[model samples]
Target: MAHRHDDLAGHDPDADWSLPGWLYTDPEFFEVECARIIRPSWQIVCHESDVAAPGAWRTLAYLGENIVVLRGEDGVVRAFHNVCRHRAMRLVDGDSGCARKLVCPYHAWAYELDGRLTGVPMRRDYPALALEDNGLVPVEVEIWRGFVFVRLEDDGGPSVARMMAPYDHEIAPYRFEDMRRLSDVRCRERQVNWKNVGDNYSDNLHIPVAHDGLTRLFGKSYAIEAAGWVDRMSGQLVDRASDDPWERFYQRHLPPVPHLPAENQRLWLYYKLWPNMAFDIYADQIDFMQWLPLSPTTCLLREMTFALPDERREMKLVRYANWRINRTVNAEDTWLIERVQQGMASSSYAAGPIGRSEVCLRSFAAKVRDRIPEARLHRAPPPGWSRRVRAI
Candidate 1:
């Protein structure tokens, strides 16, 4: 049977159609998504504090590309391929650390923090090699509100600043630049496509039924709006007691966060930067999460929370409450999304209609389709088909 991909061409932004089932289950389509939609896009890796000091480095494997974010002696942050030029051995084995220079573990080839090939075991062994050209491949790096973002390919799309301009004034209240890391990075792998997680994140209709903790906190008052490529969700925190005892106690005794303006005192603001990253801002702290596709049917979820340096007892209680409620919400979401993945793989499944409340999800799918037309396929394209496409 023919697929619905024909509808992707010049589709209306408000159309109710969802992406086809094959996009989530096909391995070939997944790779196309990585190259077309993810690789060329700016992806948030970690906060600037991750590589705050000279010589500090953070490494990540993203869509088959191994990347290292490092701070050089000049106090500038740079990103590079994690492979050594010679023999292509991985230069770093750990997730993060500090070192004067990066040394290849296999052949002892070394490079400066800025990615210059400064040492090769025996200096005179390679007379034909050009040291400058042999340095690690550089990736585009940008820092916005203390979040470090790296683009694997130079697609010349909008810079991080341009992408975030609409929300700059709104986010200034958080003083993200001054905020320090408040929790160790938490990473969990899930048996679902990354897009499945993104679909759940942009869907507000499931909040009441899927996320009980969030429903208790927001009282069905959450509102989501999309501007340019940024989607913002704001919910007014309720003052009433909750059905759960701890949740009730949390609402009644929520500690004061004076750093946030009085109007923002009881508001939870969530911002989704298209394709992969999401920032969640609450009264006392801000956290960001990213979904990395490990395979066609698996993804890695990474999250980190940040806050102003506050050591008061009341603030500590508030942080603890936030953590407790957040865990409950995440668990609920995980359960729902995992089932959605299973459903996508079913033979009876078909593209469904988007709801009025799912405009953000529609917009996300639109952006993906606009960039990679192959993603609109309702069934997997034939083998070696992507190589024949004129454009992704």
Candidate 2:
């Protein structure tokens, strides 16, 4: 019997590169995503280093729900719903800080670092209420390689280890344990949809035309290949052929570090998880971007962290240079996505064909439609499910 992947050989290369128009503009679809995708999937809350010491805490917004991540006196980090049990007042107001106890600003209902209700402003008023039962609701929190992830679903879908199993080997070399957060920049209230941002970053087929600065620095013939679950794109500097100049420059002013790749000097890897997270790894630093949907057309593209402690000064300088390169590239892509959104809103527009190079994007859309079966109610399962079930 032929394997499932073998069947992909006959898949049409001219197939449409578009998703349903309603996916980007429908309010009901966004609500369904919040329930099925955002809430159930593992989410990055903050880095473990951010809440290292006892009482250190950070507040984050998840699917419109306020969440607080805190390190207890025992040095264990945990996540809790930020709302107070009594009157639902927010316990922690600011971004992050060390606090001995989380005291509600409204009613002074205090909670311990472990999320236990330790004090009430007026215990005499509500004698019938049980403090033990009314403690802050705890969310599942896990720390993997210094990054903290939280899951809000009651079922506890998958462990962080399993969710990130795809890129474990690629990330091992980064030494995430030794890294520290250097900067964070958030783009809020953006008019583009969240999927638009994700679809922009998922593939680099347009990089040569979209990012002229980058294309000029690292030649336009950059190669893109997929390995396991991650996709890599790389390009080499044409001018840096001989090692004599680089060695001389390194000897004079820079510390020892490997020179760029011979064929592809600058290797820029962009990895996208199944749902909505992206990891953009450059030579010196890594960018963790999470695209969160606030509404159908408005979303938050948060730059959660830029971390690199190995070559702080050099990385900082190069980071800004790459940031400028990325800004230009993102602007071009976002413009196209916004245009697509507008076209989607138009009554005349319909689905269009995806190019041969856009297989990844097509695969991504298929996977999305597969996982959220409700989205593809018309299609039957592709052979594997029934065969595997019968084999079992």
Candidate 3:
């Protein structure tokens, strides 16, 4: 990929913005991201309520590694590398379940809820091996406001609280702990790059253009501002903005949502932590999505949860309506991002400059560049070199 900071030279607001095309399409670069970026980041595994009882377990895959998070007999949640100590076979096959002990199907290597090796098939065969030392390797697990997060790396950075510092005040009032997981939808085998999807969510500039249905119903002309790990994008609902038959019909049926200050109404809040996690908070509910890159071009998007426990049935219905609106918006984004994937493969493309209005996107790209030192070098090793060889 070419490095030309001068591309945005005349565009003062976007002067320093540059994202190499290879970062989105190169398999080598994607591997590096999995190691340096994804592995060390705090990933949401499951909600605490999901594993409320002892022996309850949830299985997940992160950066090519299978993980199992379970509530132990002691009633504390713990995470383990989902592989068995016996023959390196996977211990948990299903997404989630409750079990007295996690038993590997291949060899029946049973482990206690705390990941202690309990029953190894034909235990007499390994007289020299110590069961205590050969138990399932534990991963770092933490719970914040009912959300369970797991860190794979031994030297992972700050806690989830520190990482979410920017939106602490805004999210506190939501009383996330009181909310329950109502529904979840996982879209697997996505054919677009994970970063492309994340980039689309980070900026709401396309909402007015790509999401006509949304903008038409809930006015546009929104403002987008970035503050560390969070970004605020808000618009106003034009009073009696439309008299179209369809708009008027729905307006008469639906109760009015309390309007914010003209400047604050019709807001779309998109909060992202580095690597691949997004927590989008709307007025009625929250949408938590994570981008799991399976390869350079294929990714898995999991709409982990949508909770609105406190809202009335009518309000919940409205929240569901808003969720559908978001679904429409996401479908529009996926259409364009997939097209970009095809365009990225062309030799004619090299790089692109961020738009002045895309301040959040520019900030995201800057963070990516900052964490990815390889972006500074003309030729560098693949992204996962550190993980593959255990040397940076």
Best by lDDT: 1
The order of the candidates by TM-score, greatest first, is: 1, 3, 2
Q: Is candidate 2 or candidate 3 better by lDDT?
A: 3
**What's each prediction's TM-score?**
0.93, 0.82, 0.84
Best by TM-score: 1
**Residue 191 alpha-carbon offset, candidate 3, angstroms:** 1.4
Q: For each of the candidates, give the backbone clash count.
A: 0, 4, 2
The order of the candidates by lDDT, greatest first, is 1, 3, 2
Question: Residue 32 error for model 3, in Å?
Answer: 1.2
Cα misplacement distance, residue 148 of candidate 2 (Å): 0.9
lDDT tens digits, residue span 132-221, model 2: 998899998888888888888845456666656766776666667766777754655668778777777756666666766556555654
- Tens digits of per-residue lDDT for model 1 on 1-392? 00112132255743577897878888888888888888888888778888989999988787878899999999999999999999999988778999998999998988998899988878798898889999999988999888899999877678887877878888888899988889777889999999999888877778777778778878867887666677778888888788876677667776777666787888889888867889999877898899998999999998888988888887778778888888888888898989999999987876787765566777787888787776566666788788788455
Q: Could you tell me the lDDT of residue 239 within candidate 3?
A: 54
lDDT (CA) for every model shown? 0.82, 0.67, 0.71
The residue-by-residue lDDT of candidate 3 on 9-98, one tens digit each, is 233333355566667778778877787778887888888888899999887786779999999999999999999887789887878889
